[model samples]
Target chain A: MNPIANRYTELVGIDHPIVQEGLGPFRTPKLAAAVSNAGGLGTVSMPGMPTDLDAGARTFREHIEECAALTDRPFAVNIPVGVDNNGVVLPFTDIYIRTVLDARRVDQSLAAQLTVLTTSAGFPGDYIGMIKDAGLIHQHKVGSTRHAVKAAEAGVDVIIAAGFEMGGHAPSKAVHSYVLLPNVTEAVDVPVLLTGGVRDARGLASALAMGADGVAMGTRFIASSANSDWHPTYIQAILDAKEGDDVAFDGVYGPCRGLKNAASLKLLNHQEDGTGEVIDAVELTRWKIESMQRAQTTGDVTDGLVLTGQVAAAIDDIIDIAHFVPNMAAGAAEILRGLASALPDTEHAFS
Target chain B: MNPIANRYTELVGIDHPIVQEGLGPFRTPKLAAAVSNAGGLGTVSMPGMPTDLDAGARTFREHIEECAALTDRPFAVNIPVGVDNNGVVLPFTDIYIRTVLDARRVDQSLAAQLTVLTTSAGFPGDYIGMIKDAGLIHQHKVGSTRHAVKAAEAGVDVIIAAGFEMGGHAPSKAVHSYVLLPNVTEAVDVPVLLTGGVRDARGLASALAMGADGVAMGTRFIASSANSDWHPTYIQAILDAKEGDDVAFDGVYGPCRGLKNAASLKLLNHQEDGTGEVIDAVELTRWKIESMQRAQTTGDVTDGLVLTGQVAAAIDDIIDIAHFVPNMAAGAAEILRGLASALPDTEHAFS
Candidate 1:
């Protein structure tokens, strides 16, 4: 048994203290199920999901069923509330609440598999009560300690402390994980999951050492074969990426970090909401989702916003998802053992 | 006996894989000595050292003697070249060369104790020859991997990689430690010491886990008994500081991170360099040094630019310098031990 177990694994009933965070609309289904099957909880993301609510709900239901069919292990469904889908302000909260209720009505076992519901992009204020009522283990992503505290106060089951290094739509506060994780972990009683800049077992071990209960990795997972759904060229981009290749840009929602490509540069130059974007009030929601899909589906790597983190610099290989998390955990264990043995002798010598 | 020994300890003859980075002008002597005696290398800093060359040299000599008297262990002297102190463009490179030669002339044993000469703030090409001729270990600080590679190419013995969260003058690249460290560590063959956002043993352990040979800390040491030379009120301000209290300002050198006190806020609003600096290149160089000193010795935390880092959020109490590094290293060891036991079992269970 990996000694890396923590409150996160116990709370979510997983074997490992790692989480695959939700990507934008259409990032999971197969990938999410693969992560869950590997003993670490996987997440199916639909941030600003479904341009058409009813049709999107049907798709969401189908995706949930597909993941359930693939893995018996626990998984999560990510819904970024308060995002505008172009001119249509997506009723993401309502869709999320209804999706949970409807999934349970359709199949209780499938509903049970969704051990957690993760929200990001905007304040989950109006939807907390409804989320709790749906009996979902709620996890809210925050970029600063203040936001984490607010989420905890509002009764979020877990706080995901994401730093400025995170890809996709990040918290606007720009607090880094190294500083923000400890502050959030100390400020809240709930288990804190460190997000952003984590790639392997070393990162996992480091997070555990720094008061985080676990870690949530997005970019690392994106580089694996499990994420075959994402463009192969995109994965290659990540493997080839170096420091400074990833940059922050104002997308349709808010601050997004990704490997610099043609789409992101255009987004950066766009006039509007790069600074104080109310993700929910944005009218270009549909365009944003489609752009990511274009990036994901288009064989071309530079066409869509390829969301990623700075940790992309460290990713050099793509592996099977089943082997990815386990191998990383083992490598981290070896390093820890060496340090443990080495540290004691040094301590004694000093004493 | 300490298994934690690395190239850093071997290079400098210290017991622990930790370094006390030179804080800006007016730091060290006692602090440096305390750190060296505690088994980690300590550094006496001199950035924009003194406008008065003669008096500055006397004071510098006196401080070095004091450190030698306090501990026979190896310590370091830091000189940041290309800085203007008041109306004087301090001949820092010249002063550093003369100081090293003079120190050797005065007392050969004292010269032996000065095991390392660290440089930062500007290109070190001109002074590398003098450093090499003196037979002292050479270390250079950099904010980016490109700079690290450059310094490594220059044949520096070590590279001190700093992240954006570091206090005093920081890298203008703004790349963070999590991203920058691995890039630099992978890009260069020389030993790398991580700086910024590290406050305790956990940070030290984390740095080692991430390819760094050792760790360096400045802000963490600032809130310590060893740093009594810094105003009590300024230290108190760090203890009392809430998240977001620190801000980045373009001071004399480049970007500087410090607590946002009245002086800092005024600087923020000023013209070119903030504080109405005009940034005319000439008019502002002198103003930056005085502002920092005013903040350092005035006993008024609000009046001076109180240099600090994001780690200030993690610091809750002051400590004795002698005990600070050792206790931190031990604490880190204990954490690593627990993880080692915990991780191996999990890996075996999964495997």
Candidate 2:
């Protein structure tokens, strides 16, 4: 394999500067392993609060083990810094984090494989050292430049700067990709990966041009053949998706974007102002986030939410997971080469 | 000069694939000519409603004549189709369109230089024929894919797809640049130019990757030195701007983005119910749009509105207007070359 060098690739030891986003609350072991084998940093997203702390840890451990068994390549696990609406820490976060950190301690095979930890949602300051101490790269995702600066200050190894267009739990600040990407990349010293509204090679190439070292895509991965374990109709929902198919859901700390359907519409319609008689907003938010995963399993487009980014509108066809990253890498490579070939003969370089 | 071939450049007869946005509601004769002369399409934004219909037409004609006097290169004029809150068409739109069309007929020398008419705010279907019959190129700017299809069906020569992040009058739909751009470009067959949130060569390169033929920047142009005719402090304001400094003003059909100064704050806070108000909301919106010009002339940063896009937050320094397009061109060229040189040999390229 030809090594395309970048800070993100070097830091994570990946062949391509692409990260598979943590899609929904699922143990996507096959999907993650498929991406990693194809030379991209595949990430297994921590599933929603399991029956209990033990179940949550067991689920995370199973995912890590399953992915390790499938591929010899390095992979990462995403654990959102679980925090409630009231800024209080939630349960199951520690259980999940320890599962990834101690998985190598439990099994030597997975130790070298699960080498990276990506934390999102809440602040990473308290956990950055813990992650680093475990001998893993800590990459934190942020929604705004202020949050990015905060994440960088916390001594995170890398920053995944997400825009408002991302599916699942997105940044509270509604800053778009092009606007937020350059800002965070310019502000922080850490290598930045762009997320949200990115679907293909052009999106990846555009991220590199925007000063991001790599890209982390969630919606694109959902449409991949490797994720065929999900309902075929769910994948079909993504392909049949058109512009403006996504809507916002008040989940966790902020709004999460996903395909608008009966489930999502119900979330939108629940515009509670707390004036009504006794409503658990935070619990309801958590339930809403958890319910989204049902869409893929139940194959119900209306009752369950199909979490995807605004980029879903542009995705006309589905590609096999085997070709996804390589295709994106090669397309970006060709685009850059094409642009290079078109360069004018000149000594003048812009500062 | 090496010609960067694109539909936007070829259609508009510009060397580089860049278009300077029509700024504010005043005569920008010097600004328009300088960009056009510098091998990019410079646009003269139609001045706001004059004292009367005769005065409005006269001011537009004068601005067109002045732009023609400054450069032999082609330039365009932007006429926003003003629509009120109650779905009423505001006055002075027809007069302005006629003025642009008849100006060339009034003075044959002005005909070739003022070649394009870009209609925004409302539908262009009503006046597309009049301009086409006048033998002028019709380029309309729309905020969404639906509007782009409508404009294309209206027989316009080009589609300038503007995103929600744009300054001044923006679409009611809050679709972002990457989302709106690819959507419109895919939906319509016409040549598309991405507007809003573009600052430098990276932004232009990203737009090209997203399938846009070119980029039109309003906030970036405001920070240029060639625009020295405006107050220095105004440029300084743009330089000092940070992310989220720009916000939406509920003017006309949608929000008008600008620096969140005293004037914009007042507009936002003026959330009228239209219950018992004797004032016309349409006239109020028009006045708000017109009053934005005072920021350049009066230099009252607090009281007058400063129209700029989200990209303003990233701009730190100013360059001469002469170097703007060339700088962007060279920077994009270098970036493309750099990416090309860094590419690894691969057998994969996405179809």
Candidate 3:
């Protein structure tokens, strides 16, 4: 008897609906494995794109294998489908999707553990059928109701509704979770997981109340004890963040939410007045990716790009995934029950 | 046995926790009265600032009187406290506050009906004492947890935690409800009402689940049939709104959310590059007010400022306040109970 068992948990064969979502351009195999072993779904994030597509794919494969080796329970892999101006999928996205499929095809045990493939940043148009054919649950992350509907209609197994307050790459339309969740949930019949501004039991309960099946968190999981792959300084910055410490700046994607540090401020200033030193579009994109990796690898939180959600301001303590995941589900259940019982029996008066 | 009875309903003396929040610069006496009659809190919005300070106060007084006359139930008045560059309370804010206090002093009946006063825009500083001394429930709307703590410490009876997606004047710090509500509720002992991006039962349930005592809606109520004070075209504009149709612009206060029409585009264009023809600061402020007023009075949805929340995308039909208010509360309670029952009894396993 799981405190929170729903379509999401059943579909992925996990004990709880809690998910450690994609924290790409950073190493997250250990964090992913910890969450999965704790009975929640963990996701192996894509590594930073390199000049050689095969090199990027190999790194992504290694992370997935590391997570699979650590956790016997089901987990996921997140590949952001980067597209060019012409809507053609980028080489990195193409290679990474293949890497996951290739790894699973070779090893039966690895295939059983890696049961979900989540795509974001752009539509997983052609790759949707390919992923579905691989017998993996295909979850596409979208920021708008229209996109949610489009992805659902296109046979995507799940929809992770991304809000403007989410860290790293955010939706271009800027709809916040309060509005976006209900809209997306109402528009599609697929299981909806809210991704943005979610931290604890209250967030999960709120997501469930708004018709979301689960919550996929990035910033919260990043601050957890299991996430030792990232630099401790990055976690400290998240813990020390106060209100208005984060800002949305131009990224490889349309808009990205991150700490308002020297790197992000420089990007913001350049976006506003076009005053920063001239860099080509390709060079700038590569530089942004490298900056994000630097923060995670070298603990350079000041000059390096620190991607985080607005909810980071409220997160103060590091959590242990083993206790936190199941406890979160139990807490949400208690809260929902308490709220229900608290409401007076006004059906006679109203009805 | 009210469907949604809580600290908010108990503190405010309303049957349901639902609230028809402020729709300022527009008339809403009839809409407010209808909500009050339906056992929810109704708020009489502040009229636009006029060249004649006394006349503006008079208009506000008349609106309050009209709402009181329509409903014997307790109602509220929303006045945004405007401050000058030196932080001195503006003449209009001073006049409006006195106008409500004076109205009650002169007429006991009006005092009995108008039991609440909600202040937004700036901190209620000196006016908090005045509002509490008047025996009115003082609910100060804030966007950050710091402000909520400050207002609660200052003795505000209630705190309406406003999110970034709210219509009209938004908070200077762009904290969305997903991140803002739980933070504000945790920071203060006073009852917190979630305002912004809320509509219908799911929104109410989500608000309550996130530790909010209730929900305060502006855009949802604006599209109601009771809101006849606003032009039908204005209502139609809200009905026609879709995802990505609303934008936040430089407002009279910090920022304002509204439909992306000619007037808003003009303001946004000017804000970006300062390319719009130079106008005196005072004159520009006056124009923005007049434009907002024009949309309400005349059917000028095209050129006038059509203030609305991001939730307008999901609001396609006009609701009747008589049924919508109480039904919304009941629906939320039912949903909460249903969700509580649906969860598996995994308490033993988790514990």
Candidate 4:
């Protein structure tokens, strides 16, 4: 095993350094539990209910309870705080955070097992004190080194360097993982979890070599059996993709990378023609809710956009969690070992 | 737009199909003359002894003399094939080819007008037949499908698919343009030229888009005052590359890709690991000669390995070509004419 392996293992208390991203609506109790049980961190996204903070809190609590029942291993919850549709406040920021904290206070079992809380899409500096006070590790997703530095200063436990290749709403500024990972890792003292365009063992090896502690995969896990209900066509499209198939489109807030299908083409055209103006928070919420409902319930890939990472290019096949998680770990370990063995001998060898 | 524009238009008869492959020692004055004077072809290879029976008759004839004296149209000669030790074979190939054909028997002035003869590796391919043959055009060198196929099959008249990514021995297999362009365009029936990795607009746009009639390039071309050698680091690396960067070992005979580096990994490695041996001829050559040599010559990019055409990865920055070779000629013409305004009757159209 490589030295980074031991360090990552110690940091995450897992056999491998693979972390599954929190895919909202797609993230279910079973999926989270399966990833956690597979010896990697799994995260569940807090449920949102438009403007009704109380209702959203209730949904989140129930979801948390379900995830707790599914796995005995540690997992996390992702809270996204940012501007919403209609320019009106969504209230998910404070409501969701307080709900998680309140739930931790009331449920001893949940508090004991929930190992991490991931904050994404917006700054988490304000909530770091609350999260640490509750004794949970904090992970933040950052698109640039500046964001990473900010996260580090805010006491983020792990920094996820999300590059432009990532699916869903990625930062508009374009910085690839190759350039971003090294820069961010060098700047921050915290352990870095590299995201975006990482799909296989080779990618893992490369990232570790570049100074990342672990990899967080979104698209790869989404294609697994745990996500069987995901539209088969979308899944197949991802599987068939070669490296450069995807194109990023301007989303409501930023850029989102997905399959270049008719809907996406329409969105791109809209951006180009300057006709698709930004909808406010309420309108955005309704639009997303409707789109997700159409997509998830009806299996309309065109209606519901799938969030994926650039690593989708390498995912030619999908397997069960039981097989995938272990294979990923083993493959990385083997490559790392080979790389280490090839290195020139040092004075500390065997001593 | 660019200075090369007038030269390109004059050299290639048809608006967009004319190109030259940067061949090496194999490049001959007759070959360049045959292509350029034909009004459709241009070629460039190494400026050494013409190898082969036909070249002997054409000996003492310089690339410039043969090409310029043959035709007034634009033509070019590539000289970088002599940079490495393997280039020794270039003179031999040139001598043999020149000897077999009585090139001296032909009109020397007519031969001097040959347009282009791309050169790379040991020597250019023996092209005395096409040069001396009736109505034959010649162009050579390629990097990928975008580089070779159009030239090969379009009958535009010579094609060279070179795959040295940055410089050095071409990869034995996983990353050379030889394997990529050929495999993708094997159906082509025209003359195919091969060169190492080229460095220019004419090279980039032509090869990546598969529209070149032939290729003529030199890393040193950019270092010219007439050239734009983007970076000093890139220029020095190309000049310093060795035979290894240009040679392949264990080649299966066809083509391969990759750069020379410590890993020495090839596409063959993925074919079948059970036997612990390579099973394909093409793959073997790619690793041994092409990829290995490329690594040695390119420096740190030895790991960078300069093999392109698994394109879809944004590996190269796009440079402007003096000429525009539309991928779809008819469609481009229609768009250029603003035919949308001339469409009759229906304001609405259905696919």
lDDT for A185 (candidate 3):
91
How high a TM-score does candidate 3 get? 0.98
Residue pairs clashing in model 2 are none
Question: lDDT tens string, model 1, B126-183?
Answer: 5777788878899999988888999999889999998888888887766777777767
TM-score sort, best first: 3, 2, 1, 4
lDDT per residue as tens, model 4, B180-292 = 33333344555343344333222322232232233333332322222221233333444444322332222222343333334334333333233345446435443443433
The better-scoring model by DockQ among 2 and 3 is 3
- Model 1 earns a TM-score of 0.88
- Model 3 chain B, poorest ten-residue lDDT window? B342-351
Q: Can you write out model 3's per-residue Cα lDDT over B69-109, one digit (the tens) per residue?
A: 89999999999999999999998888999999999999998
Ranking by lDDT: 3, 2, 1, 4
Best by lDDT: 3
lDDT at position A341, candidate 3: 68
Local accuracy by lDDT, each model = 0.78, 0.79, 0.92, 0.52
The alpha-carbon deviation from the true structure for residue A285 of candidate 3, after best TM-score superposition, in angstroms, is 0.3
Candidate 1 overall lDDT versus native? 0.78
Each model's backbone clash number: 18, 0, 1, 133
User: Per-residue lDDT for A193-253 in model 3, tens only?
Assistant: 9999999999999999999999999999999999888899999999999988999999988
* Of candidates 2 and 1, the better by TM-score: 2
